[model samples]
Target: MTLKKLASRAITEIGAVLDSALPHQVEVMAAPILNAKRIALYGVGREGLMMKSLAMRLFHLGLDAHVVGDMTTPPLGTGDMLIVSAGPGEFSTVSGLIDVAKTAGAATMCVTATPDGTVPQSVTHVVHLEAQTMANDQEGATSVLPMGSLFEAVQFLFFEMVILHLRDQMGLSANAMRANHTNLE
Candidate 1:
């Protein structure tokens, strides 16, 4: 019963958090998606998977979207955009990537739980969400849920909302995205 209550509270609280911030996040993501010259994405670990999913939807919307570290991650020399998800916003490798992208003059956006972290200063856009979920297997200072599971789940949920917004704005058909889904699957 103790375990059940903890799980229930975590889910409800995480849901409440997303319900509050999602509208603003989608609104922030839209302008860059609509106007970007190039849209490259980066995220670490499970967050990377979430960002990859968002990038795929952007591709379905006909934007020039690609994941970072892929063969197709072309130079974002100017006016191009990089969207990264960093929950704590202080992951070492992600910080380094932010540094490189900033030096190259790429516009960057970070969706993070910590607004005060290093990436915000280096990037062009910021979307801050207050999540009580930890990342990885450790209990982060900010996570109420163990090991960031709630954080990972919320990230996935947020991307789906972003896809919904993109579909409406870009006029993408379900058939079109379906066509792009890997045939190997």
Candidate 2:
């Protein structure tokens, strides 16, 4: 296949995966971030990178968002939220953190390809992205991309859309968000 053909295929698959995500789920996920006194985010591998991107966006939005395991991350409890991604459904580390967050009285939200899976089923809220993750990315998978790339790519797009929704709902201007960006860079 030509490079152009491959790129088209990739884009089409991404759109299909993203289309499966429900708007109501996105609203529910964003609601906690808007109301939480503090928000902590986590994920493993490439998924973790996506969470960090979201953390940066939340900070630019003037929210108290932290990446879990970061040195400056504070303890989460009531009025706090822990947003995590475990796209195949559950990673042991993700599940452990969710257990701790729940016990600490923090609201837990999960973004996963398998909402019916054990870890997501345990969360307070979930935004299901029906993309191909490593768990199902073997023979016969629909995505032209390899492994969990589809899930990770859609995660970035989904989080960006969530940020847009959040900005509109909070009546925040782009300039205000830009003002919060690091000036040292």
Candidate 3:
């Protein structure tokens, strides 16, 4: 296939995934960010990278957001939130962290393609990102994106839309968010 065709295919696939995503799920994901005193985010591999992107955006929006396991990350406790992604929804490490957060009195939110999985079962809220992940990306999957790329890509876009809604909900202007960007960068 030509580069143009590949680009078109990717765009079309991503659009289809976004179209089917439930608005209520996104709203559930956003609630902790808006209400928590601090937000801690985690995911593994490409999914983790997407969560990092979201942490950055949430910080720029003036929320106290941290990537889990970061050197500067403080302890999570009451009034804090932990947002995690487990697209296939059974990562042992994520499940462990969720347990820790819950034990420490923090609320948990999970983003997953498999809502019925063990990790989501323990979280306080869930945002179902119904897309193909590496586990289910055999011959019959609809996305042209490889492995869990579709889930990760949708996560990046979904987080941006959540930030947009959050900005409006919090009465923050674009200028205010920009001002929060690191001057050192």
Candidate 4:
């Protein structure tokens, strides 16, 4: 196949997979945070940055949300939600965080590319996206991109979509969210 054709095909496949996964993500993400006292999120590398964005949106939705290690994040208490993004589902740091989540008696959810992998069984919920390509560039002869790029892009896309869904589900106003934006920016 020509290089252009190969790249185009890769794009099509990734878009379709991410689109199909969106509904499942929206459906699952909504219910868990609805009644929680707060949502403490975790992820590592590129995935973790995406979680930060999601947490920011959650804060806009009038929920208490924070990145796991941030000073404002605080410890997860009973009736809280711990959300983590584990693209491969076996990251060492992710496993460690899940242990903390469980110990605190909080509900844990992992968004991963491997649902049946090690992290799935230990968590309360899983959003699985088995990606064929991701953003990590590497020196190889492969036509498609390297690991986790598509996954990371789609993770951000879907998380932004969740912001819209949360507004509808939880009755948040865009004006209110904007008001919450940092004035020091």
- What is candidate 2's lDDT per residue for 1-185, written digit by digit as tens? 89899889989988887676757767877887898999999999999999999999999999999999999999999999999999999899999999999999999999998999888999998888889999999878988888999999999998998999999999999999999999897
Full-model lDDT for every candidate: 0.78, 0.92, 0.91, 0.80
Winner on lDDT between 1 and 2 is 2
Query: What is the C-alpha local distance difference test score of candidate 1?
Result: 0.78
Among these predictions, the greatest lDDT belongs to: 2
Each model's TM-score, in the order given? 0.85, 0.97, 0.96, 0.86
**In model 1, what are the clashing residue pairs, if there are any?**
132-143, 132-144, 134-148
* Candidate 2 off by > 4 Å: none
lDDT of 3: 0.91
On residues 51-167, what C-alpha lDDT tens digit does candidate 3 reach at each position?
999999999999999999999999999999999999998999999999999999999999999999999988999899888999899888877889999899999998898999899
| Superposition TM-score, candidate 4 onto the true structure | 0.86
Model 4 clash pairs are: 134-148, 134-149, 134-150, 135-148, 135-149
User: Looking at model 3, which ten-residue stretch has the lowest summed lDDT?
Assistant: 17-26
Superposition TM-score, candidate 2 onto the true structure: 0.97
Ranked by lDDT from best down, the candidates are: 2, 3, 4, 1
Best to worst by TM-score, what's the order?
2, 3, 4, 1
- List candidate 1 segments past 4 Å from native: 2-7, 133-144
